[model samples]
Structures are given as C-alpha cells and as structure tokens.
Target chain A: MEGKIRQILKDHGRLSIDTTKLAVDSDLYQAGMTSHASVNVMLALEGVFDIEFPDRMLKRSVFESISAIQTAISELKTN
Target chain B: MTTEFSSKILYDDLVKFGHIIPVGVPGIFGRGAVFEEILNRFDAAVSRLAASDHATKVHFPPCINRQVLQKSMYIDSFPQLSGTVFSFTGNDAAHRELSSRLKDDKPWGDLQTMTDCCLTPAACYPVYPTFTGTLPPNGALVDVQNWVFRHEPSEEPTRMQAFRVHEYVRLGTTDVVVAWRDLWLQRGLKILLSLGLPVKAELASDPFFGRGGRMLAANQREQKLKFEVVCPVISSEKPTALCSFNYHQDKFGTIFNIKTSTGETADTACLGFGLERIVMALLKTHGMDPDSWPKPVREVLWA
Candidate 1:
C-alpha cells in the first residue's frame, strides 16, 4: 500500500522532491505539492484504492503526508 | 502563453504613464491620476447603459462584520483567499513589549488580535444580509461600488490584493433575474467593445473548495450560471476575466430570507466589473499612452 501510494504521488502529485527519496512520513506540502495537485492526488487515490474521501477528509491537513493519507484510506475502508 | 507583454514591462509602463503607483507590496498599488480618470470614465459609461434601470446605489468599505462572513459561507468555500483584520488589543506592558520588539526589528504582528471584521471578500456580500422578508412586485435592484479584498498576491498587475468592484445585483424570480443577467452580459460586452477592447464572454465558475465544490462548479457551468468577459491583459492566449455575470438561482435569497411579493424564494443575479482590471486591460491593449488611442475610443472615454 505504501509503495502504491508513492507511485500514485509520482503520477499525480506535483512534488518538488524525487519520488524515490520521498519517505511515507515526509510532508507533501513541504515538498511543494499545491492544493490543486493535492486534489488530483486524492482523485487518483480514489481510483487506485476504490475509496472515496469523505468531505471532512478533503482538507489540506489530511493530505499533508503519505502516511496520513494511507491511514485515512485504511480507516475509510474499515468503516 | 505567448505574449510580448511581461509583468516588468507592464509595471514600468504603468508607472511611466502615471496609471499606478506601486507600494512596497506585491499586489497592493495606488491608482494615479490617469487610472482614476479611466475608472471614473468607465463608471460613467456603465451609468449611461444602466440609466433606464434604476438601481439603488450604495457604497461599502473594505471591511465587513465577521458574522456577515459566517452567514455568507465564505469561510467554508474560499478560506484560503479570505483576509481578516487584526488589531493591537494589549495592556501597557504588552505595548511596551511590542515597542521593544519593534526597536529590536523583530516581528510584532503576532501581538495583535483578530478584530470583529474581516476584509470584504466580495462587494455584494454585505448586501445580502441587509435584505429580509418579501420584495416588491418587480423585485429589487441595488447598485454597489465597494472596495473588496482577497489574499491573492500575484505578479500580474491586473490581479490586485485590494481593489474596487462596481456591481449591480438583481433580486426577482428565476426567469427575471437570469434574463436580466444574460442581457447585461451582452450589454457589458458592447460597453467594453465600444472602448476598443477585444472582449469575449465565456462560461466560468468560482474557485470553490474541496471535492463537493468541484461538483458544484461543474453544475454551475452546466447550467450556465456564470459568465465572464475576458480580455487579453497579460497574455493573448490566456485572457483574464475582467468582468463577470452570475445567476444564483435562489442561493442568496434563501440565505437572506428574501422572497418575492407572493412569498416564494427570490432568485438573485449580479453583474460585476473589476474597476482596476478594466484600466489594466485598456492600457495593455491600447499601449501605455491613452492620448494615442483611436479617436472614437478617446472620445468615449474623455467625453
């Protein structure tokens, strides 16, 4: 799931850092991902994981890091 | 996009032509004599076009009550773009600390507290809360010239952080408001074209927030709820939205509890013009020199 999330970030996220070097705990916003690009990431994640982000989870902080996003998807799937 | 005009060139020309006086900030600028003249001339042109339609004219400052912003849902949709006012509300000891910090050339803005009002996000925001109960048979029309603020700092001269918007809002049934909005969209194009601007009216949407906002924007475009008069200010390929016409089908009316004479929810629409953008577009299109413009255009503006 972490590897796939990194791949999704590479494909859809507009990060300034290299995808290979970006850790799961690294802040995406600090890596230069914009709010618009974050939306694209969310959409791509939905397509990949088959989980829609609830409106409450569509905030900037939710997509702050790869781990946070993975946790959000995991919690949504469990629920 | 492909364009000969750059921000540096535009900025220099604006200063040379006495159209704008740049402050230390990126997007905050003071209008010079010629720029103010152009704004007044454009306002007069709009007045002439709207002469037959009597709208109760009002003016608002750059600040609005915080409660008004909460009621308008501005915080929900565009919190990133919103600007709130802050002030120093401290005891004498805190003031002395602030003075010491200033003496040390340290940050002092953190000492201030958030005020009761935020910068006016839109010229029409304060108008909605003022309306209550039923409207007259033909409904109501209001003319507003207000200074609005948004935290969008850009290198483009047309995109200012603080500027004025001249708006005419209509409250009536869906058919009436939409028809009026549509009519004014054409009239607005004519008015700009008369000044020799190559204007194009296209369907557009606001910068809504989150995934739900994406759907709302799509729906707005699908229903043709918004239209903007775009002109090539900075780039010829990608023009700027200098003016906009919006048809809000009972959104504002429902929020403000405004109704038609029969007590049904009233539909609302507004035709708004960015006064600074018009000036910028005119300068960009017709060179920096206003005297060298076409004879008809000069007469329309100066007459």
Candidate 2:
C-alpha cells in the first residue's frame, strides 16, 4: 500500500516534494493541487487497494496528503 | 457476449465525443452507456477549470416550486415551455390502467400533477427559489451542474429527453454578474479547446416558450446578449450548442427576490455548457483515441 501511494506521488510529479511542509488538516485544495489530480490519486489508490472510496469520502479533504490517504487506505482495509 | 468495452451503437456514437455515462442514473433522464466516457472526460475538464476557490461547485435540480416561479410570473414569461409536476386525484390509478393499455404503446397515468410543479428546462430556477433569496457577502458565484429536461422529442442525442448541464453562475451586483460570466466564458473556451473540440461562439437569446418566443429568440440573436458555443454536431447550420453565456440582468434576481448587500435587486449571468454536445464535438474532433490526442491537450486534461 505504501509503495502504491509512493507511486501515486511519483506519477503526479509530487513525489520529490517534502511532505513535512504540509499540515494534516490544511486543505490540499488550497495547497495548489488540482481536483483532477486528486481524482487520479483516488483512482490509483482504489486500484492498489481494490476498494471503492465511499461517496461521502470523495471530498477534496480525503486526499490532503500522503498521511491522510494512508489513513483512509487503512480504514478501508480494516472494514 | 458482453464486449470487453461494452460497446453499443448509442455508446459508440457518444464516445466519438468523450462522454461517460454516470452510474446509478435512470434513463429518460440520461441513464445510458453512451454518456459514460463522455461524462468522465467532462468531469475531468470541470475539475480542472472549475477548481478555483471562487467557483462554488453546486448541483441544482430541475423541479422548481410552482409557487416560487408563479410569484415572479415566470409562468407568464413562457407558459408553453414551463413544466410543472402536480398531483391529481385518481391520476395514478388511471395512469396504471393506461400503462396496461401501453402493452400496445398507449399513454398512462394522470398527467395533471405534471402540470403543477414543472421540471425546469434550464438549471437555475430551483436555486432562485430555495438558496438565493439573498446574494453572497462578496456577491455569490457558483458552479452548478444539473441534469436538465426538455419535452422536445427527437432521435438525435442532442435533443434527448434529458441531458447534463455544467454551469458557472453568479448572482450579485451588476458588475459581479458580468465579471463572473466573463471569467467563465474565458474558462469555458479554454476547457473546450483543451479537449481539442472545435467550436464557434455566437450571441444567443432566451429560448422563449411560444410564438412570442420566436420574437424573443430573434431579438436575442440580434442583441447578442447571450453567446452560444456551438459545434458541428447536428449540422453546421444547426450546430449543437455546447455552451451558453447569458446575461440575465436582474431577471431572476427580481423574480426570486435575490438581493445584493445593499438590498437592491441584483442581476445574474450564467455560463452553461451542454455536456453531451461537448462530447459530440470531441468525438467529431479527436476520433475515438484519447491516447493519441495532441500532447498539450492530453497533458492538461489527462494528467
């Protein structure tokens, strides 16, 4: 799962950027990310984990950063 | 056999344009395989262009409260085109019996309720009644996507019973209304061009409901208060309108009592894009291969 997330960052060209700068709750929307990229991230994660993201979690806040996405992935796997 | 691509005549025809059918939507209102790919691309384009913080993305419904429109005499503005849904006694029983008759293709049910609260022909009516009694603090700007309905029956996908609308809307001061539409107009074109869709923009007029509607339509054509982004879908002479930027100078504001901070009636302008028409254009423009689309176009939209 971590590897897939890493690949997402790579494909999105956001891999090399330091994640240390992003705040967990800080909106990725305001962080200069495109919604299209966020959708790609969701699709990539869904493909990797083999789970459909629930309609409720499709908000932009769901993919705020590597940590947020990882948290969502864990919750999905557990359920 | 279920083809790997689930290809259909209807689906392929729409695919020639880049439409994706949304899942779980009912037909007679756009539930079909053809819209699948086209919607997907349109979603991608919308996410890219409508991503700005200022654009408040919204989903509007077509069923406007008749009382709300009636107060403003919107009913008087164009009665023929205005659709309302109403409930009448025994209409349902009569309708069921009629459907049984439709075993031979006959009409069913009480259509009286269909007269009371109408499905909005355009996307903005419901918003006026429920949400926008007053404008935003800095004046409201919204991006509303809706499924619109029209009674016009045609075999053409362009004139189907239902279709999706992507609109960037604004309601506020006159300046705000004009600015919001101008910004969306520019953005609308950029997104269309990015998809490699060829289009022409022309001034458009209100789709007035009756014979007088013709004069209104002609007047609109003359004044150019509205601009239509069209492509060669049905034909060059009657190109499908992929997008329309209209300046409804306080028309809705006055009717819905939508007001600016100063308590004066404000105007609204909406930039609406016909999702199906765009896909039609894309089908006409790029052929069936997204992978081979021009690099710049593909880069902006795909990744």
Q: Which candidate's lDDT is highest?
A: 1
lDDT of model number 1: 0.85
Compared with the true structure, all predictions reach lDDT values of 0.85, 0.64
In terms of DockQ, the best-performing candidate is 1
> After superposition, which runs of candidate 2 have C-alpha atoms over 4 Å from their true positions?
A1-79, B1-35, B69-82, B86-88, B91-116, B131-133
Deviating ranges (above 4 Å) for candidate 1: A1-50, A53-79, B1-3, B210-212
Candidate 2 TM-score to native: 0.64
TM-score of each candidate structure, all chains considered together: 0.78, 0.64
Write model 2 residue lDDT over B14-45, tens digit each, in one string. Answer: 53444544333322433345445556667667
- Residue B168 displacement in candidate 2 (angstroms): 1.8
Residues B1-303 of candidate 1 have per-residue lDDT tens digits of 124757677877898878888888878988888789889998888887898998998878889999888776777678878998899999999999999999999999999999999999889888887778889999999999888988889877887889988999999888889889989999999989999999999999898876846745665676688999999887778888989999888777867899999889899999899999998888888877777878989888877
